[model samples]
Target chain A: MIRIFKIALRNLLRYKRRTMLTSLLITLGIVLVILFSGLAGSFKAMMIGQITDSSLSQMQIHKKGYVSSIDTMPLNLTLDTNKYQKIEELLSSNTEILAWTPRIKLNAMLSNFTDTTNIRLNAINPEKEILVCPDVGSRMTFDKGREPGTLLNPGEVIIPEKLAKGMNLNIGDPIVLVANNKDGSVNGLNFKVAGVIESILGPQGKEGYMHIKDAQELLRMDEPEVIEIAIRLHNFDRLDKVYAAVSSKLTGFINKKGVPEFEIHTWDELSPFANIAIMIDFMTITMKIIMIAIVLISILNVMMMSVYERIREIGTMSAIGTSPSKIMSLFLAEGLLLGLISAIVGNIIGLGGIFILNIYKISFAFGRQENLLLSPTVNITELLWVSGIVLLIAIFASLQPAYKASRMEPVDALGHV
Target chain B: MALVQIENVSKIYQTGDVEVAALSDINLSIEKSAFVSFVGPSGSGKTTMLNMIGCLDMPTKGKILVDGKQVDTFNRKERAAFRGNVIGFIFQSFNLFPVLTAYENIEYPLVLIKNEPAEKRKDMILDVLDSVGMIDQKNKFPDQLSGGQKQRIAIARALVTQPKLVMADEPTANLDKQSSINVIRLMREMKDKFGTTFIFSTHDPRIMEEAEITHTLVDGKLT
Candidate 1:
């Protein structure tokens, strides 16, 4: 085996140009696969991490009919205090429930003295909301001496940072919020800017949040309406079970439409980017397949030429009593060696390219000024997978030519001119 | 004792429905340690006979026995073992592996047999190289060596395995007259020194003259 491998190695080296070209193709394929897949995976991970940890837990529960349409503004689900207490008690007892927060949401128009913009207002309980949405408190600041725990004075509100800048409103500036009440009455409330919050949840500066009690009185819901419930599980992987448990426990509840129902939506269902991530993953796989095909063809062509060029030598070995299996092993070894060397080369080049790009802080603008999407980073798992794939492809590509070499008749081979 | 016996052997080749009788009803025997040659014109079955004798090809009609083992009945592995242990081959074209140096070419057979220790293989290769007068050119590739030197290395490769029989198919066909004479003389000397049988298929008169026994093939039959 060792002897045959040595001979094969020497034979491959004889055609230096062909060998180098084949290896280069393999290296390029491996590098591209690693680069794109790595970027896609990292980008998806970053997005999910940001979304899940910053605001949305793995799952969310809302009034069943409320989510179907956005036209029902200030829509609220009324939970019986005793029933709500039981649900909270059940959640607290279930080890799988990591955290939970209830919120009241309203779609309203915010108007400064000069400009007005539409926004989604989330009225949250600061203490309970922090467990699920840790980014909320730290993300807000007030120029007027209002801190996170400050009770919401009758006419105080927190505006998003982007909204305040665009509308030319400062902390003490007065604004009007116009919203539709559950009774189909249009209502307007005047409030002072207690704080400014920065959030990527909605458009850069288009959304804000307030204390639940303040929003309830402003939206004219005589009875408190819990608009939505967000829950975090100890293991996100058990999202289906958590959703099932919550749905089973809260099936009959009077919502804004005066119906008895609630709805459950997983985080993946809420985020449209989850589908986009899946599509990108599929695209990465397609690209890898195409690259592997091209590399295999290139390597196969080179190996075929190599086999033909060494016909006489192969014949001599056969005549000297080398078995067909030994001959096959020799060629296979050569292909493996080529693959291994090319993988190393490709990885070095790919990683080097990524490193240079990252070191220079190279970023491409893919969105508006405030929310630019950065190029995805590479990770170790992608590198290892690409290397393994390249090695397999190299071995696969050499099969036909190696078999051809092994099956040649010694007499015919030696007789070649 | 006869080292090789060909019993009424005949070989037929089929090329697109055209039957060609390369060898017909040939019976011959060669004793151990004999330097024998098969001389014939082109297309007269010299190489075909050599191929059969070297276990590279099987006879179509009759049995071939090397050291009392029937060649036709041997399977692929058996044939390979027979070729590796019982016979060595030197080709007319000095078919040294182009990528290998003369030393490596000589070491090739030893590596294939896989029974010898590395030190023993080294000693044997060096000894064979010395015997063939190719020691100085051991590091040179086939393309770098002269025709005479290549043939000498081929001879060294053939003998390094210490086989019972060494088959040379027109071994001196590519060399000049002086080199040819030197190659034949070296084979004769090696045969005497090791008591190893030597067989040749050639049209070279020098080899025919130097051979202890000469068989002539005419129109695929010994005459």
Candidate 2:
């Protein structure tokens, strides 16, 4: 077997120019796949990280039917004090639950003395919210008089950038928030603007953050109610496992109507940015298909030509008692060697390209998120899979030509001039 | 016992709408360890006779037995195995694998067909290469050697397998007069040393004169 392989290698070397050209074409295809995989993979991962860490935590839990009517901000559908306590206990006992925070999401009227407009506000405990959404504080832009990382306090609110700009409001400026509680009662609270928060969904988003205590007072809620509970897991890759475990544990809790009261959702279910991530995956698969086609065509063409040019040699080998199977294997071996060598070369150059990309630290923005650096890198298993696919395609492409060469009649083949 | 027995063999080739008889009603036998030659003009079926005897082609109407085995009835794979194990072939073109050195060409049959051990194969190849008087050119590729050297390597390759019979179709057709004499002499020497039968076809009267048993074929009939 080794002797035949050596012969196959020598035969490939006999056509130095043709072999090099074919190998270069295959190598370039492999390099393209690897580079695209690295860049697109990194881009998808970074975008998911930004969305999960700043906007949507890894998963969320809410009262049944709440998400369907989320636009209405229905206060009556909020989880009651007892339900909230039970969920808090469940979250605290689960090891995979790194953090969880409750929020009272509602629409309120914002009054800056001269201008009044509607705004969506999420009332949260500053310290707990930061744990669930660690990058949330990083989105805040504080003025000269305020600290950078310091989030909302009991009497301060962080308004949206568009609202702050439109209403001509600044940090430390006093503002009034008016809200209608669940019982058709109206109340208002006064607070100072702590900072301005940037929206990751672009400039169209108008949402603000406030302290839970102030929101409770403004809505005149005697018992704390939560519209939603955001959850953060220790490992995002285990989101499905943790979500399943949490869902199964929470399944036993039934409301008086005898139905599950809560719905659990992963970050992807709650965000539209997941579609963009899916599109990126689709493009990656398309790129791989293109690479496979390139390998198939190049290898098939080269092997066919090799067989055509070596017909007499094949006939001589056949006449000398080399089996048809051995003849077929000879051609296959040439293709395998070509694929293996070219894949190795392509992998080295591709990984080097990724390394250069990382060294340069290319940055691009999606929506309002700016300067998101692309750290392009591929794992070992992925690299091996790409190489293995190319090798398989190369062998598959050589099959017909090899079979044709093996089946030739030695008498007729020898008679060729 | 005869190493090869041909009984009433005939071959007909079909070309489009026409049928041509290349060989008809031929009967012959070759004894063991004999240096035999089939001499004829062009289109006299000399190659067809050699082809049938070597199991490279089948007779249309008769049976061929080589070393007591019916070779004409063998399947394609069986014929290949038979050729690899029981017979060796030499071509007029000195068809050495260009990518292989002379030594490797000689080692080809032993490794690929005989499955011989490395130590034994090395000894067998070197002995044959030395007997052909081309041992010093063993490392050179076919293109680097003269036509005579290439033919010597081809003879070495054929004898390395130690088969009972070696068939050469026009073995000296491509060599000069001196080279042709040297190749015929080397083949004769190999037959004497290895006790292998040598059957070849040629149009050259001088080369035919060297064969111990020369059969003349005219118009597909042996005379």
Candidate 3:
């Protein structure tokens, strides 16, 4: 076997130019796969980060029926202060929980004393909200001239940039937001416009933000009431583990109806753009299939030519008592060696391409955000996966020629010029 | 018993619709350790007869026996195994593996086919290399060697397995006169040393003169 391997290697070196060209073709294919994987991986990561950190956190815990009818933001359905405090305590106890924040979702009408528009308002605790999303304040367009914004305060509110512009509102302008209490009585709040913010995620009309106290006061609640609890974990990779641990602990703790009180959801379940991530994965898979085809065709062409050229050599070896299987092995070994060398070369070039890409600080607009950075990377396992696929294709591609050479009659092959 | 037996063997080759008789009604026996040659015109059956005994090409009719076993009954794998164990072939082209160095070419059979032990294989190869006067040229590839040196390496490769029978099909056809004479002399010396039966198919009278027994074929039959 070692003898055949040596012969295979030497034979490859015999046609140095052809061997190098074949290796170059294989290397180029692998490099394309590696580059595509890196770029797609980075894009997916960025999109996930935008959806999770900018709005959803990694996941959310909500009152059992809250998400089902969340668009209505039913003030009658909320966790009272006790259940809220209990969940907050559970979150504080788990080291995996980096931060958590609560919000009272309210469907209301916001007016600049000139025109009124429907809005979905989130009443939040300023400090904790900032901890979960440090960029929340930065995303706000505070001034009528589109200046940076500040976190909300008592008697203050923030409206969407598009809404503020259309309503002709300015910094520190006064607006009235109105809703109905559980008793079906009309309730209204007076507030000064503290900031106007751009929406990083979610649909339009989710346009208003205020202090949690304002929501509790307007809805006429005695205990601090909240409909949603957003959570951030130390590591997003462990989101499922932390979610399971939290869910199991929250189990068996029922509300008055003896039903589980809260349900948890990962950001992927909550985000509208989850399909984009799947599309990226599908695109990557399609790219890999194309790459495999290219490698298979390239290797088949080279190996077929090699087999034809060595017909007499094959006969000579057969007559000298080498088995047909050994002949097949010799060809297979050559193809495998070619793939392996190409992989090594391709990986080096791919990594170098990624490094150069990062150093250049290439940026592009993604969705509504600008200056989105590109950081391409290929992990060892992924590189190995691509290389393994290429080699497997190479082996398959060479099998036909190898079999033909092996099955040739010694008399006929020896007779071949 | 004879080491090789041919019993009424006839070989027919198809050329489109017509059949050509390469060999017909051949019956011959070769004893062990004999230097034998078959000489004929170009289209005669000398090469075909050698091919049958070498297990390279089977006859269209009749049976061939080597060491008392019917060679025609062997399957493809069995034939390959038989060639590896019981015979060696030297070709007119000096058909050395061009990519391999002389030593590696000689060691090819032992390692790949025989699965010989590393230490024993090394000793066997070097011993054969010494006898064939190619020990100094062990690292030289076929293209780097002269015609004489290449033939010597090929002969070493043929003998390295210690085969019971060695078949040469015009082994010296591609060599110069001096190289040709030297190749025949080396084969004669190796036959004496190993006491192995040797067979040659050639048109060279010089080669026929050296054979202990010469059979001539005319129009696909012994004359």
Per-candidate total of colliding backbone pairs: 0, 0, 0
Residue lDDT tens for model 1, A209-323: 7777777787787666676777878886687887787777676556577765667777777766678778988989897888778667876777787788789878887888887
lDDT of 3 by residue, A1-417 (tens): 666677888888998999899899889888888888898898888878776766667778888877777777777778888888999889999999999999888877888788998777888898898877666676675654542334877898888777788899877899998887777777888999888777776532245788999998988887788888888888888988998899998885787888998888888777777788889889999988998987898889989999999999999888877889999999998888888888899999989888888789668897678999979888999998998999999899989999999999998899998
Task: Write down the RMSD of candidate 2 (Cα, Å).
Answer: 1.8
TM-score of chain B of 1: 0.96
- TM, every model: 0.85, 0.97, 0.92
Position A358, candidate 2: lDDT: 91
Q: What is the DockQ of each candidate?
A: 0.59, 0.87, 0.79
Ranked by TM-score, the better of candidates 2 and 3 is 2
Best by lDDT: 2
Best-first order by TM-score: 2, 3, 1
Whole-model lDDT for model 1 versus the true structure?
Answer: 0.79
N/CA/C clash count, model 1: 0
lDDT digits (tens) for residues A1-417 of candidate 2: 998889989999999999999999999988999999999999988878888887677888999888778778899888888999999999999998899998888888999999998989988888988998898888888777666567888999999998999999999899999999989899988989989988875211346999988888888989888888999999988988999999998888888999998988888887787888899999999999999998999999999999999899988988888899999999999988888888999999999999999999989987877788999999999899999999999899989999999999888888877
- In CAPRI terms, where does candidate 3 land? medium
Interface RMSD of each: 1.5, 0.6, 0.8
Model 3 clash pairs are: none
